[model samples]
Target: MMSVRDRLEEVFERLEKRASDERVYPKVYWAAARAAADAADERRRAGVTLGPLDGALVSVKDLLDVKGEPTLAGSRIFRDRVPAGEDADVVRRLRQAGAVIIGKTNMVEFAFSGIGLNPHFGTPGNAIDPKRIPGGSSSGAGVAVAEGTSDISIGSDTGGSVRIPAAFNGVVGFKPTAHRISLKGAFPLSYSLDSLGPLGRSVADCIAADAVMAGYGALVSTPYPLSGLRVGVPRGRLFSQTEALVADAFEASLRRLSALGARVSDCDLEDLLEQMREATSRASIASVEAAAIHSDWIETRAAEIDPRVQKWIALRLATTAADYIRMMRKRDELTRAMDRRLAPFDVVALPTIPIVAPLMAPLIADEKLYNKTDTLVLRNTTPINQFDLTAISLPIPDVPLPVGLMLVARHDQDRRLFEIALSVESALPH
Candidate 1:
């Protein structure tokens, strides 16, 4: 049996090996891990009680400000920028909980896409299938956790960046209610939609990380029980395009939940989807806010950006002020509609990604297919951001490729959602 110290050292060694490959990220800072481990050991020796994550090794998405590491956000344009003076708020919380910040992980440049391609820095390999994508812009962060290089990974989720990879890589990924966790030092993607969250191997692991990041006390021990829970299955377009494996796995999951005594019912919230599309038509919060954050850089370093990313930014820049205002107004309307529709169920359930992770080559070659798959991949997850709901993507068993079963709850019901998720997790086939 290995001690926590020994285990963490092993993780650090793995980080070194992965970083040395130079395929995951442009650079890694090992000194930070050493310093954190020493501090953790000192605290333990002094007889100080620690949090559940004490001494656990963790990875931060490169988009985040990790002191002394450049906030690349997966772009070469900011490669020369100086290191951060302070850790992002989430990083600070992890430190306070005694987790070691091992190294920065790669991401899609500026987190512009769900596909997780970084032509500049090689994309992280998916743990389940090397040839497949690891999912982005939290690409490498998910890999770090799935590959056992870290106990937890802090990544940003704006339109499923965190959940997409976690699902594709067969791990647990959680996105808390919007604004539940502070985003003080993380790079901006979409100020309105961007959220900081974690990827881990188990629901318990995700819950532990979330508690610390949210500044909430330790998670209360909640037994998995589904005696009276109402879980809505959003039928129709939401589940229309799921692959055979994913569809079968989801149906089996519902049967298991039924055996566990959950009240599973079909729900049609087609209105929610319509509202979301309408809200984002003129100028999405993601486009408008990200454009604002990168306007200066885009103007000066346009040529330095990835062609796909540059085009995305260009589209944002083309939007008029009226478009932005219209988008915001419609966003508010959509939020209210979602809240009303979701009120009947404890949590709504859906597949995390419509299709399994596609081959990397085709996605890169055909921009149309890439855009199409990207929208479908994020369709279920993005609605939570629009409604400011708390959600979690738990792995569905027996699926050919990793596919996640997502559960969503109303704002401020994060803990409740987690409790429900535990039951759902157990109900899925092993």
Candidate 2:
């Protein structure tokens, strides 16, 4: 095995070798990362290891506060904000597990968009194709893992921010159940829906990182048996706009699982989806919560905000407290309904995003096109957040442009979701 120190050096060299515009990390902790790597290397020589995450190289989203640094959350407005006095909860946990913290990765402004473009900090392009958009708001975290700059990267997922990038970059991203990990010291986009997650080279990587962040210490999942496992495919509007390639890949995955003795079946939830839509018709929980978080800035420094993100936040300012309350209550009811609907399946599987990542240029040039594309990109993964379910996106093997096979489990069943994903990942043709 390579020494942790040597691995860190190689990652730093690879990052330094990249073109400036192609850089993934905006803020790097060179001294801290080096110190952590040395300590881990010393432990290895002494025949002692902290845990599974020990010596792992990790990158965090810019939204997470590292003591003495301002949390940018990928926006220019926070450039001069007061620096944090302590590391975010997740960052602290990562350090305690002997993980080497590399630095902060770029993301969409305010973590409000799924397109991953940051006008202030240049977007990190797709790992597979430089011209394509890397999925976001966890954009750089995805690229860092895919390109081997980080062994695993932490990201926030309110509406597929983590999974979208993981899918685009051909990596594994796991979003734990909401509130599974403390959000202390992290910038808030949606108090109601925001979740911290990990994107890594493989499912095991995510599993280890997740356990550390959740304060579970060293943890592992026993792969669920695929034989007789019930896999539900929610085939409805969520599957309607899937590109032919994505559709083909998803169907093939289902076939493979079935051949392995898994019971794969289509599960319809159109009526439940309709109810969720109606519940949030007044305003989305994310947007409404975001409106509150940015109420001051939206009123005074609206021009300083990303126009794309600001527009949506501004629109939600009109959501009266009554409407917000009504939405939340209804959402609570719908969450229960969704859980009941999902009870029959071991896991619900779907295409993470209905289409592969699109070229970045056109979307950036046309504002209207950008909005349309963003909506499409977020459509599939956002529902999991709304319903409070735990989900993971695994890259479909051998795809030209990466597509994700998303496996969703009932709320708070994060560990089980990982176990199921492990089985599915192993069964897939590598």
Clashes of each: 0, 0
Tally clashing residue pairs in candidate 1.
Answer: 0
Point out where model 1 deviates above 4 Å. 16-20, 25-27, 42-47
Considering summed lDDT, which 10 consecutive residues are worst modelled in model 2? 14-23
- Top candidate when judged by lDDT against the true structure: 2
lDDT of each: 0.82, 0.92
Which candidate leads the pack in TM-score? 2
- Model 2 backbone overlap count: 0
Clashing pairs in 1: none
Q: Which whole-number lDDT from 0 to 100 does residue 161 have in model 2?
A: 94
Model 1, 340-361: lDDT tens digits are 8889998888888887888888
Worst 10 residues of 1 by lDDT: 19-28
Collision pairs in model 2: none
